[model samples]
Target: MADITHRRVRTNGIWMHIAEKGDGPLALLIHGFPEIWSTWKHQIHRLAEHGYRVVAPDMRGYGDSDCPADPASYTILHLVGDLVGLIDALGQDQAYVVGHDWGAEVAWHLCLLRPDKVKALVNLSVPYRPRSPQSKPVEYMAEKFGDGFYITQFQEPGRAEKSFAKYDCLTVLKKFLLVNGPDLLAAPRGIEIIDFLETPDSWPSWTTEEELQYKAEKFRSSGFTGALNYYRAMDRNWELLGPWQGAKITVPTKLITGDKDVGFQSFGTKSYIESEFLKGLVPGLQVLVIDGHHFIQQERAELVSAEILSFFGKRSGN
Candidate 1:
């Protein structure tokens, strides 16, 4: 963090704040739900030292980036448009894009929507989800997982914002990052999300209290409304992205995910990833199933960086 410089760059219709270092070919790191650019602290340092300019942004709705008042502003088209503007703002024709969780969703779209801007991709956790022409995202999510699902619970706007605001940001960060194993995601009536923070889960050796404070402070100031808007706008994204239906991500790519990650363990997600689904979409693709949870980059920083370096070496000849 000491060496990394922070600055705000105007992109799309918002101002995106980015943490950047190094001076070689660009490596743009996109963070996910409830996470800030700080989540990629290790990657920023490692990738920079390895001779590449690494830029990790607050990403529109998170951290120091500008957050629009409407949830509708958080669509994938908006997110991808920001990335294109970010690469352009940095004076680059293309970049090696990497994303985790929700960031992975954006990365996939970036490749599909504007493959010319991305040289290659290394995504973690969440896999590419083919659009469902049968129904809107919210409709099927409600039918299959019910309103109790985290994504569905986020649909009602202020309800989840109030629930998350019940506890301090540090506690919320701890509960979210340190949650052990994959469990069914649900927030039943009368139960606040902060309830998960009450117990002392086994401490993770990778993160320090000081680091957690940095992330907590960002969320505390920005509030959770902007982050929750990602889910709130999914249905709208589905409608807006219909033009690219049946499109495949033709970029050279590698995907890594923890066995215990919530996205990996989601019903049929593992099967789809392991089967022809992923390869059919990502023609030049590699997959690595590592041992860990959702926050695999931080929990296994050295290993994750090694994987990224190795993928760049093999895939893009970096």
Candidate 2:
């Protein structure tokens, strides 16, 4: 295994921590909710060995990065700004951006906000949801998925945060990282989210106890508010992105997801991914369905990295 390096960078008015390795065209790996850059532990070394510099950041919060106190500071614009600034700080004009879950959402918006900064993108979990002209994201989610929907539950500032805090950070990370299937994620009122884990299986065989603890210690020290704030600012992002209505991600792209991942099970996500809905948003997009869980990158790191390396190879002619 190749050793990874760390650095704190000033970008988009905030300081962020980035984990990176290798020395070639930059590949910025952005992690999603309940995870930090360490989530790409497997990809960093593998992708680096494939001759691409891999840089994974903790985003604004969730790890050793600066956590802006206000939830409103977490809008899509803020996210895109952080990434654009990151590339500048890295002394590069562009990077092949790879993201998962919320990171995927940000990557999609990053392509829209600054296509010049991203050479290509390969994302996992979330797909590109075109800007909606109907209702605000939070209200629409509450109406369609009900208040018990996890996003809705997180809306009342500090509500879900307090609920999540009741569990040990390691326990919370284990539950969120290990979840499977495509059930609409929700938390009943008054129940701590950790209670929903059901049974904690022995740490997924892919990651060791030490690996889990490195992630757990970050959350235990930083808490999860910065990460959860991404959810809290959902509607604000919708409002802020009004000008980007009907925008399509024109960058070279690919989406890989576990067949049973919750995002795939969502109402029509699977069909859409395989149909014109996804292609309409991302023309020439490649989609791969893997037999695994939502955390596909970690659960099936080799396959995920291979897909990424293959995608980069085709895109960059490496």
Candidate 3:
């Protein structure tokens, strides 16, 4: 951890802050909402020790990275462009990419839009869903799960931010991070999501008070608007990425998710992952379902790091 260095690199019209260590091949780690580069601290140390450079960036809106004010700026193109520019800025033509949650969504598009830039991929939580040509993402989410659905509720610019502001940053983080199941995510019709989500009396053994405070402090300083803007740009992404509809992610890939992860449990994702559907889209794709929740990398750090090492090491022939 002491060898890890932090700096900002200019890429895709913005400066991105990253935490990095080691010096072999690049292993780009992209984080999801409400988190920072430190989320991969465990992986960084382990992967570096195993002979690969691991760079985890706070994607676009979170941590010390630049936060563009326009929701339109957070589209899939912008997100993928950021990573493409990042790979170039890092002096690498290709990388072994790993992402979690929103980061996984971005990684999927990165692989789709520019497979040349990704040597291989190991994404967590979110699986690749082929674009639906018939409906925009936000509208589709509304039709399928109604407005109270978290993603649907996140559509309105300031709605979720206001709901989140009701609690202190620490409590707000706790509400999201400590959630144990998918069923607890959606609010009951008119209820605000942050208000609906319960805060646990005790913290999980995998995470510490220090880590939570660090994440809370970053969110408090940056505010949630930029991060929530990713959700706000869902429809825009659907519009802008129309050309990529039904595109296959040809890169060798692995999808590792917790059995209890909200993304895996909700929206018929389990069936999607289990069926031939996912394999049809990601050819040669491997899926690993483990015990834990959405933040599986952090919760099961050793297993996650080992899986990553195994997958990428094989790709690199190390």
Using TM-score as the measure, the top candidate is 3
Candidate 2, residues 72-96, lDDT tens digits: the string is 8998899999999999999999999
Summarize candidate 1's per-residue lDDT along 1-318 as a digit string, tens digits: 689999999999789999999878999999998899988999998888888899999988899999887998999989999999999999999999889989999999999999999988999988888898889988897898776677777788798777777778887788778876677666565455456334445568988889888999998888888898999899999899899888899988999989888777866667778788678888868889999999989998999999998887532334
Cα displacement (Å) at residue 238, model 1:
0.8
Off by over 4 Å in 2: 188-192, 314-318
lDDT of each: 0.86, 0.86, 0.89
Tens digit per residue, CA lDDT, model 3, 1-318: 588999999999999999999889999999997788988989998888888888999889888999988999999999999999999999999999999989999999999999999998999988999888888878877887776788888888888888888899999989888889768367788998888888999989889989999999999889999999999998888888888777899999999999988877776788898788888899999999999899988999999999999998832333
* Model 3 alpha-carbon miss at residue 33, Å: 1.7
Query: Candidate 3 local accuracy as lDDT?
Result: 0.89
How many backbone collisions does model 1 have?
0
State each candidate's clash count: 0, 1, 0
| Leading candidate by lDDT | 3
Q: Model 3 Cα displacement at 263 (Å)? A: 2.2
Off by over 4 Å in 3: 314-318
Candidates sorted by lDDT, descending order?
3, 1, 2
